[model samples]
Structure formats: C-alpha cells, structure tokens
Target: MNTKRLGTFVAAILVLDAMAHLYWLVRPASDPRALSMAVLNMDVPFTPRVLLPLILLLTTAAIAIVAVSRGRGGWPAKAVVFALGAGLLVRGALGLVWSSGLGTDTGTPFYRLNLLLYTPVCLIAAGSVGLVLARTRRTGARV
Candidate 1:
C-alpha cells in the first residue's frame, strides 16, 4: 500500500487499541481476575491507573502517526512513529512465542486471543508502519 494508506491503517489500529483500553477503564469486567488473565495472561488489576496510561500512550501513538503521515511534524514525529512500530513488532514477536506455549500456558484465554487477534494486529500494524517508513525514505518525503 501507499505510505498514506499504510499510515492510516496503523493509526486506526492505535485508535482502536486506545478505545479498547477506554472501555476497560470505564466498564471494568465483572470478573477482573478472569478479564486480566484472558487479556494480559496475568493477575494484574485492570484499574484506571493501568488503563489510563495505556490509553494515553495509544492515543499519542495514533496522533504521532497522523502527524507523520501528513508530513506535519518533522523528524521527531517520524522517530516516535518508528519507536511505536518497533515496540509493536517486539510485542507481536513475543506474543507469538508465548502463545505457542513457550512462555505461557496454552489453555489460557490469553493464549488463544493473543494467537488469534493481538499478535496478528500488532504484526500488521508494525508492518504497515514499516512500509510507511520505507516509502518515505524512498520518496525523500518528510513523513
């Protein structure tokens, strides 16, 4: 895809992630334990203290993506986008490994969801961002 389209795709993914965190923050699951296990593969509380920072981070990522895509922000914006892509790539790779029962239990809901949803989304978003970076480099555009 073109750089613009790729950036838009990545930004959408980030926005959706932010929305999901917002949902968790506003309407916590009936069973926080189950929800946490299913989502994070851990027992950590899904409180606003946790979700709020995630929401902010995801929102910032989306904004940075939009700015970079529009060629509005300079290298600093591009750097943020690059960092976001790298972080997603690492998370996806780790998810793939963990979901395969290497680091996490295969029977857990998180394993299934990570394998089916989270991992793929992260990988796709990372790839889209990578494509945008490449296109910008090739075209000599200030993305």
Candidate 2:
C-alpha cells in the first residue's frame, strides 16, 4: 500500500487497541482473572492504573501515526512512529515464541489469542509502518 494508506492502517490499529484498553478500563470483566489470562496470558490485575497509562500511550501512538501518514509532522513524529513500529515488531516476535509453548504455558487462553490475534496484528501493523516509511522516503516526503 501507499504511504498514506499504510499509515492510516497503522493508526486505525492503534486506535482500536486504545479503545479495547478503554473498554477494559471502564467495564472490567466479571472474572478479572480470566480476562487477564485471556488478554495478557498472566494473572496480573488489569487495574485502572495499568489500563489508563496504556490507553494514553496507544492514543498518542495513533496520533503520531496519523501525523506521519499525512506527511505533516517532522522528525519527532517520525521518531515516535518508528519507535511504535519497532516495539510492535519485538512484541510480535516474542509472542510467536511464547505461543509455541517455549516461553509461555501451552493450552492457555493467552497462548491461543496471541497466536490467533495479537501476534498477527502486531506483525501486520509493524510491516505496514515499514511500508509507510519506505514509501515516504521514496516520495521525498517527511514521515
């Protein structure tokens, strides 16, 4: 895809992720433990304290990506988008390993979701970001 489309795709993903976190924050699951396990693959509480900051971060990332998509922001915005992509790439790679039952427990909700959803989304977002960067570079536009 072109730079604009790719950036929009990444931004949409970030926004959706932020909204998901917001949903968890506002209406926590009846079974917090199960929710946590399904989402994080761990028992850590998905408290407001955790979800709030994460929500903010994801929102900020979406904004940065949008700016990059429009070719409006300069280096700083580009840097944020780059960092976001790199982080997602790392997370996706690790998720793949964990889903294989190497680092994480097998037959768990987290493992299944990571394999079916989270890992693939992250990888796709990361690749789309890379394409945006590349397209912008070729067009002599600031990302």
TM per candidate: 0.94, 0.94
lDDT (tens digit, per residue) of candidate 2 on 1-143: 56777878888898898999899888888999999888887788889989999999898888888888778788888899899989999999998898778977778888888999999999999999888777777888854
Question: Residue 57 lDDT in model 2?
Answer: 89
Query: Which regions of candidate 2 are displaced past 4 Å?
Result: none
State the local distance difference test value for candidate 2. Answer: 0.86
What are the per-model numbers of colliding residue pairs? 0, 0
Q: State the lDDT of candidate 1 residue by residue for 1-143, as single tens digits.
A: 66677778888888998998899899988999999888888899988999999999888888888777766578888888999999999999998898768988888889999999999999999888888777777887865
- Which ten contiguous residues of candidate 2 have the minimum total lDDT? 134-143
Q: Candidate 1 local accuracy as lDDT?
A: 0.86
Could you tell me which 10 consecutive residues in candidate 1 have the lowest summed lDDT?
134-143
Clashing pairs in 2: none
